[model samples]
Target: MKRISVLAAMACLAACDKSGFNYDNIIDDGGSLQYSLLDSLQVQMRTVQLDSIRTSGTGTGLVGSYADPLFGKFTSSSSFRLGLPSETDPGLKAIYDSVELVLQPDGHYYGDTLPLQRFQVYQLSRPLVLPKDYDAFYSHQQFPVNDQPLADVTQRIRPTSGNKVHLRMNQQFGLELFEKIRSKSDDIKNEEYWRDYFKGLTIRGVDNSAAFRLLMNDTAVVMRIHYHIVKETVEEKTIDFHMNLSELQFNSYSYDRSGTPIAGLTPGADGIMGETTGNRTFIQPLTGAVTRIDFPSIAALKELGRYGRIMQAELVIKPDNGTIKNYPVPPRLTLTLADKKNVVTQGDTISNAAGVQYGNLVTDKLYPENNQYSWDLTEYCRAMMAADEYNYRGLLLAAPFSEFHTQLNRLVVGDGGSKQYRAQLKIYYLLYE
Candidate 1:
């Protein structure tokens, strides 16, 4: 039994020797640990301003104005060309009676809705001409309108509650259109000539103190002319003009962020050049604003005595709950890498069928529980360490579907302060010899 005990002790020592540790080292010190935390390392944070994004008209919406006390005021206008009806022949002596314009909602809106909002519809003074390959349109593009409005409407509408806006139009103008179509003039018969004759229509918020959203798709904007024909018995018929693919269309949005928390922000500043004196960062949709992040200290990780493989890396951004109040937060937010010149370029590691970088924002329940956004950037950080490529350029944060949609949501992030709700980057790694 004593010899068996001695052999068992020898075997235990051999096992420890194979494992690169002795009993003393194993009990008192971690001799064969695969990883160790670089205790002296922490990321540095800085803020930069993002440039204005293109507000190209996509999806199905022509949004309008609304005001927010915290985020400031937002206004939008829609311009679209009209197409004539297929059935032009309503028999002889077609007496045009009335005309109406109908607009539908896409069930999305922001800000106060209790106050009455006014909208005006005007005819464009010139035709909306565009090249066949025009990819995008900015909010700054201008199309002058006639002095007289075709229609005006004022009402309290809750688009979120499945309501729409209806406006009575000018009957005299409707009658003129009917006459021109009946006569089959070149201006009325040819599509290009029709657009030249009618130009386009613009729907804008006139004297609105509140803001709302509407889905202005092919079927959203409709002009119907009710007329009666003296054929045997007075038969009533309606001719409709639709804003569809027959012509070019676009949406324009403007923001008056004055007298708000971010009022002093320079309009077009990009990156650290646009940093404000305050210790807070702001983000707004509708090409309003974006948050830029930079990490100079991340490059220093290599200076540590060891090299490591990044097992997990996360960027956690905490939002100021008080700033958002009861406003609806954006459903998703995006993180984009910057170029070598520190410019946030348009290339994503992932691209869609059209080759356009598919910018996917992290959309999940991480925001509501802790009022924060936690992004899993492990692969990104790993690539950064491996190639040392864009680790210095940091990232850009913006909302999804905001390039073309009129979303009024905004977020406030704590920065460079003693506040508990600040943005941070956390990483867990395994060290190597």
Candidate 2:
């Protein structure tokens, strides 16, 4: 009897229409689905321009040059003052053997080692005296040099191989300097006097084929004068001249971005729109070419209605593959807030703990499929929401430690458009209403 009743009930239920079993007919409790109640979010992308970064005395022990087919050429040179070790001189009977400049490698370069280059040392015509305390030196400074070089070499060099380079100097010039020291001339008495006689020295790259880096600290770089004092016995002695740590020393750089996409745009000014700039932009340490970005519509997020709080904010940048051939990717990129005057301000929350900081770009990783980087802008967005007076006018992107270098690594990024690769913003928030 029970089996017959169960079959009769199943037959009746199956006979009902599909609407009788619809889940949508149940009463809905709305708390779990409250996400749908929040106001819609908004994202906007703005065009940027290229600004020129100030390149001056960077204290890093790096100097080199590399030619890029797209960006043209880059060159680096080191300039500093060399002075006598002491005021008192050894007695004059010593015969001068020779003078040589010794430079130790810093183990860094950006080109192939097959090509040979010419490294030449020139004597500055004027003392390297700075007018102010914090005076800056640029690559374009025009300091004259002697017609003759103290030392010159044309050979293939691998400075990153843990070796030192010794370029022999002219014996005649070495003897002349030795005589002045033996005579205890006024020129050899004090720092000022010595500087007046020998202004300074500049180690430069003359050949466009290759570039090299040298450690120029007081210990690694030296000018040695080999001589022997003759008395009853032959005692070989040597005098050393070294670079002054107190004086200004720096690498001067020059870049020729003639035929590249960067050539179509003006630099040292505001960033041009991506649409106006061919939907792409550039940043290179060698040229101090900085990319500037702005989001004019970000402030409108507050007007969208009340929200509990923002959980996070991110700015996404997509790299353009068109510029990736035949060049090493940039080691890193730095983003910072610019002031009202469009100058880089001091509010970047860049830290070591988090690889993706407030304004630091990812360097160690690159996603080939996406080829993108995301920056956390939670603090910046919060400040904007709080209506605090901020120095953050926009964002500027470039490489760090680039004040005195020609980092061959350059970057090209996409401007926002209907395309999927366009730059965009992502914000996650909660709602209380």
Candidate 3:
């Protein structure tokens, strides 16, 4: 009998008006059916520290350092091996002019770029190889480098201007490279020999430097050795070594959260409640920090009535005003299922009838009150309401994995107990006798 009544209620919902209806509106329909809207559900928010995520083969180079008042100091460095040039010989009459490392910006940056930033390039002590038991390099991985730097440069970076960053390399280094190709040594004859002779390089930014994204395509980042042929007109020639295999490149990131609201947060530990962290939660995937949301009062809905169904559920999240001035918010955000231990379940992302929800973001710079990220949580709420046992699973709000590994975008949102703009959950319920 209960199954038949549930099927009948579903049929009625399908036949009802599909356009839209006001909340709590009682449609007579000459039947004993009613609807109610509940928006006072208690929400719990927290900041969880995730384990190191894979950062290799992203095809983007990240280098620099920046200090954040809320997130502490963040630093990134890129490392990769260069391929052998097609034409190893620069001719016997070639006279070494100079060499420079060129980096093309990809128009992505964080923090202030007006100040002079310092960058240094170091030769790797060993070859670029994964660890014994590791399959891929993670954001926290690091490689040993030579003490002496090959190139050191300082300049104001303009990432979006389409200008490339050129750093003059050491003359001794360039001369030795030219000599190897000129003499036609075994080191310059093949890729493996060349890789062994010239292991790799690591580029890093000094402390307090702003982070910027650089193109890591086969031809984008290159080392060019310029030379002049002793011809009648002094003709010039160049040999280029590029970052050939995109999968060989990676970026390493580190962060210090000392003295911050989320201090002492670590992976595998229960997350810190937003109320204890100044009533706010943070989402910065680059550093493995994501926002956790829980519907603590969802089970209480059963007390309202025995035959009640959730017709719709909506979650609205608001960022604290004045939090995104220099640091831009991520364009899209998604939710994934997480266990009570704060471990995110793999391949359990949440989605609605329309597919994966990206939190339709509404930006309002003029009036911050209009800024919010809205998501449809109807299906998830229905499952929670129908569960016989109490559900301890929660959602982890974060950027997509692709963007999370490549970009350092961040967001600070108000929790349910925030004094200012707080997160809200609204559900439309239908009751039948």
TM-score of 3: 0.89
Q: Can you write out model 2's per-residue Cα lDDT over 24-49, one digit (the tens) per residue?
A: 23333564212222112233323333
* Residue range 100-197, candidate 3, lDDT tens digits: 99999999988788899999999999989878998789988899999999999888889999999998899999999999999998988888888788
Q: How many pairs of residues collide in model 2?
A: 4
In model 3, which regions exceed 4 Å deviation? 1-31, 303-305, 346-349, 352-356, 364-366, 388-391
Estimate TM-scores for all models: 0.79, 0.77, 0.89
Best by lDDT: 3
Deviating ranges (above 4 Å) for candidate 1: 1-31, 34-52, 131-134, 229-235, 267-278, 305-307, 340-342, 346-369, 382-391, 401-406, 416-418, 431-433
Candidate 2 overall lDDT versus native: 0.61
Error at 87, model 2, angstroms: 9.7
Which model is ahead, 2 or 3, in terms of TM-score?
3
In model 1, what lDDT does residue 90 have? 62
Report the number of clashing residue pairs per model: 3, 4, 0
Q: What is the lDDT of residue 431 in candidate 3?
A: 52
Q: What is the lDDT for 119 in model 2?
A: 77
Candidate 3 or 1, higher TM-score: 3
